[model samples]
Target: MSTLSERDSLFLEIAVGEKLISAQQAKLCKEFSGAVSENLVKNGLLSTEQVASLQQKVEDKLSSGNKVAVAQVEIYKEDTLDEKVVALAKERQLISEEDEKNCRKQLKKLYDLGYNPQLSSILYSAKCISQEDLMALYKEVEPNAKVSIVAKSMPFSELSLPTVPTIGTLKRKTRHEEVQQQESIPSETIHMLDKMEEVVSQISAPEIDIASEIAPLKQEEEVQEEVQEEVEEQPTNESVAPTPVATPMPTATTVTIPNFDKVLEYLENIDYKVTKLQQDQKTALTEALSHEEMEERFDSEDIPDELQRIIKRLRHVSEEEVQVAIRDGVGLENCYIPKMSSSTPIVVKKVNFTNCVIDQVDFAGVQFKNHVDLGNSRFLTKAIFKECHFVKDATFKSCEFLNGADFAKAKFDGKTTYNSSAFRRYVSFNRCGFGKKTVFTRCYFAKGVKFGEVEFTGPASFNDIFIDHRFYMEKCQFKDSSTFSGARFADIADFGRSKFEKETKFIGATFMKWGSFKNCKFSGSANFNTMNVVGDLAFDNSTFESVVNLRAISASRNISLQNIKVGNEAAFKFLDAHIGRLFVSLSSLKGHIDSHIQEDYHVARKEYGLLKNNFREINEYDKEDWAYLMEKRMERMEMKVKGPLSALKRFLNWLALDIACGYGTKPANIFVTSLAMLVFFAVFYFSSGTTEFVPSGELALDHSVKIEQSMSFIDAVQVSFRTFTNASIEGWVPYTDSWLNYVMMFESFFGFFVMTVLVVTFSRKVIR
Candidate 1:
């Protein structure tokens, strides 16, 4: 074994003194050459953090030159026997981690309240462990463990050293030794031993003189045997059995005790009945006192008769009453709490007020440390929960708020649910913070609800929420994904300037009035699919950093997307939407538009036409033209052809309308087409060998005697221009007898049609 360092010695002393590790474990750790802290952690005696904490304390003592005393270091107290048993049960997977934590918290709470409760009792009270399991665990930890029931009326001082039955020795072994010996004991024998110990431990009497007590019974047994032997020796020869003399009864002073097992059984039954009666009496006393307090408080208040009646029915009539009802399955009913304002906030745990009718109550600045349920309750007046901090799950399911409810600045650190609840008046949750998953599904808000500046650090759901008045969530932040799917807003719903840091969904939602999302930012995909709006819905001045799906949406009025920026990787989908009028700025049209519906030509065409008409209505002619062009392009690209002939025909149609005139939306295209045609004809006429041009004067002379000349490029251009305009080509004419005359005639007809198209396109553009 290595010699212990000063630090190691101090650590060992603290660990053993604090009972963090048994003395035997400490000795074993010291025998090893490794570091003390490392050995403690490796052997599962302490966690690394615990070792570090202890090491810090040791170092502080050394630096200050103060001697370490067990009494001075009271921060780490020893675990009680019940705590060890509960911990062993947890280690053996008999209880969950959450259950263990709850047990510890309850035990601490009881201790703080001046009640010295055992961990086993707390766990049993919480229904986390059963009586059988508790006894089994105790036996595993201490084979000779005894369970002694204490009356509820016993004081803490007396209860601490509960009288141990003198049936056996009460020596306790360290946990390490217990574990080493537990393997050899059969499980059945252990269970029987536990039962025997429990039965024997119930007798709280002092030690008895066993020899004196049994001496009378031993003498009576010997007398009965001697008399029986004498009768048997004389019975054979006599006609009648010798007159049986009754053995003299034991003296009255000599107590004849019953069988030992019978005595134990009788004592156990008496103990059980006494314990039960004590518990019932304690519960009755507590309730009676609580009720009297409530009645006195109620009588002192000069409230109305109707309110008094409601108050009388309430189980938890005051804040003080709430404390007494903290046990499991106890709920407040029809509570009527007055305005409470205190510098020190009240702390409550696991309060349930389900199905109650509560009047105006102010819980401002209160800190709730455990699960709170006010579900299915009716709040008769304005309920204020401002600045309240909920450290565990809070539920308000199916609750009705007749008056407005204010939760402004409240912070929820656990999952919160308000599903199916109704707020008949305006509710304000402004500046609140939700730290875990929050649900407001299937809720009704008669008046507007304000969630302005709230922060949702976890997934938030407002699915199927119905709002009869304006809903304002302005400037709020959703740090995780949020959903408002199937929500119906009968009035204006404004989420202006909010930030959705993850995916947001508004699928199948209805906005009966104006829906504004101006200046908002969607950092993830924004799904507005299958939405319906009766009035204008706008995303003006918003930015989408990812995909924006507006598929299958219907609006009876205008939908606007002005001055918004879409990221490069973002895609905009407006497929199959019933848009009455869209007011989108051209700058906002970034990323892929209608890329998903491109394969369906008809749907794509209809969508583009809607865009075109909307832009035209807004006087955005350039955007209108772009929409129109896309409409035609979709038709050309997605047109189905069954055969070569149909394919040829489709190609011709595209060439004529789209290539030449930009599908009648671009007059500039028409001009370009005409110029290209003129140039091509001029080149053809100049290059063809059979075609020749005659001068105007020569044409007037004899037809046969005219000298033929090849047309120069400039002369070909002049001839083509005049022929295309169908004007009098007085200075040039094709050879009269050659096949070029027919070609020239055909060119004249084509020129006339092209000129008509150009005129129509120009007139339309100018007029529009």
Candidate 2:
């Protein structure tokens, strides 16, 4: 080897600086050059001036007997940098020969900067299958390099990453070095193995269409990463954890928080506050006032200028206080609530409001000054108006409540209407008191709606309210007639322990889900006519003081009436309600009766008696009272029939007397004429014998007895004509005993009757 002369070294350094070589490469190149720097310069590896100056040094170095290395001369070239990196990386045996070749091919396409940290680690770990694969990956991910938003604001607490001490890394390196030294082999042996590997890699390597295979893998991984990014971008409920916040205390505010105190003082100093006064004080004071009223009173102690200044200060303070209070968390109060007038009834005014968004406005204890209009406003935060009084008519049509709304303990003195308000979140009017007519027509309650302990003193109407969640009205009182016609409850509806003092109508209310009236009391007429229910309708332990009308309710499930009571007639005339209870006790006057007799009436009476005897041992009279009452009812009917029978007999007697009085002796005369006609026919039948009689004398006489056939009409006429004068023995045959019996009976019966009838008839005819 030969040493490099100063001039050669200087040229080499300059060339290295100008992309000709590297320092380590210069050392390696000069290690075997043997003073042949001039030859290297002549061969265009070094500068020309460097070669002419280094000829004598080359001779001196050859005379010194040193060897040199030469391949590092091109270390600064693009290809040389890559080759040296590949050779160094291979010397560590960190990757296989095939991987090294493939990686070189991939790294050739990269910018001359360096290898990727991940790709280099992978290659050094011998985990990379091919360099072309890694370069394709680098190209695909290069465009995707971005600052992760998730990691920007992450703190140690949020990151939850495992930590390691600095000493642990040094210890790990030491252990790694020990493992490497144990596996260390001879460099010449490694070189030989590398050569063998190079030959084997060359022989076994398959030509790859990088655009098809490696590029596609990179594209697939990129697509997968994009999908993962999209998934990460999606909003999740778990993304924001609930943090604790301090709650603010409640504050009270008065209406029109007195901002014009100064004006009021000015008016007072000018005697404007004193509009009227007594006659004596007005004449004595003699204060000049505008409008020439009969009298005026003024405090004439020379109105103090200091008082005016103080009033102005008070006015400023009051105004600022109001504004600050509102800024903190105050809502409109008296601006929404107005006083009622005694002469004219309050009527709801029509007003259109648009694009009104109120957030975090606490309306608790707030009132309106005039008839309010909230047409299309939005209350997106907690709204409360507890214990506030409204004196004028108010209308809230098409108002949407997107958050919790509280109107607890609120009182409306005038007509308050909610035509189409939508409560999309939790809404409550718990312990609210309404004094006048309140109407909620076509309102929708989408979440929990609570009216617990609410009291309505006037007529309330909920015409078409749709409650999609739990509707609780526990302990609420309705004094006037309340209507819930065409209303629907989609989920569990509860009116447990609610009181309705007047007529309550639920006409056409559809409870598509379960309805619970666990212990509700209806004092007046309760009409649920035309109600369509799909789920189990429970009215257990409910009381209806007046008529319970279910005129046309259709129920698909079992409508329970266990322990339900009605005071008056319980009408289920046109109901399609499924008969759920086989032992229902619904009476004509009181519906859903709870009498023991009804229970026994439904049960087999005998069976009930046996059960009672076996269990409670009820008295025999108690068991048999029902039977006795039934028998007594039957006996009472029988007694009534007997009395009517006696009256009917008396009526018949009176009718007979009336007939006798109308046709007095005419009936007797007709009777006598009929008797005479009967007697004559009888005598003719006996004397002119057409009748036959046979006597039983002796056997000999019977043989010679005359037998005659009954005569025909012509023969009978001839016989009767002959018998009028003399006896006709051939055609008319009669026995002597038969004639005597007929004539005697006719004479005896008809003689007196005929004579009396003749005398009466003669007397009546003579009198006429």
Pick the TM-score winner: 1
Per-residue alpha-carbon lDDT of candidate 2 for residues 1-768, written as tens digits (9 for 90 to 100): 576664455445444534555666666667665544544555567676655544554344333311111001111123333343445555655456877554444333221221122224224223342334433333333323221111111111100111111110112222112222443423332223222221222222222222221111122233335434543654453222111111110111001111122223333453444334222223212332221121111112322344323222321112333334333333232221111111112222322233344433454555554455556555555566566667666666677776668888877777888878888888888887877898888999988799889888999999899999888888889999899999998888888899999999889998888777778888887788888778777778888666666555776665665687766433323223332221223242222322222332332233223322322222333223333333232333223235878767645433332222212334454554444454455445544443443322212122245544444445444433334323334544335444444543544464445445556645754554
**Candidate 1, overall lDDT?**
0.67
TM-score of 2: 0.35
- lDDT (10s digit) by residue, model 1, range 1-768: 789876787688667756799878988887898799998888788998889888986776454421110000011234466667767987888788877675566455335323454656545544566546765666566554434332222111111112111111112232112322543433343333323333333344433433221211113334345434544654343222112111111111112122233333443343223344334433433333344444454454333456457655554455555445653336665555433222346555477877676655677888887788888887767898998999999999998887889999999999999999999889999999999999999999998899999999999999999999999999999999999999999998999999999999999999998999999999999999999999999898898888888889999888888788878766677777788888776656623564733466677777677778878887888899888888888878777899999899899889888888888877888888888888888888878632355665565233465565655788778878887888876666665565666777887888888788888978877887
TM-score of each: 0.56, 0.35
Among all candidates shown, the one with the greatest lDDT: 1
CA-lDDT, candidates in order: 0.67, 0.47
Candidate 1: worst 10 consecutive residues by lDDT? 66-75
List the candidate 1 regions with Cα displacement exceeding 4 Å: 1-316, 326-348, 596-599, 641-643, 689-691, 699-710
Looking at candidate 2, the ten consecutive residues that score lowest on lDDT are: 249-258
Give the Å error, residue 150, model 1.
82
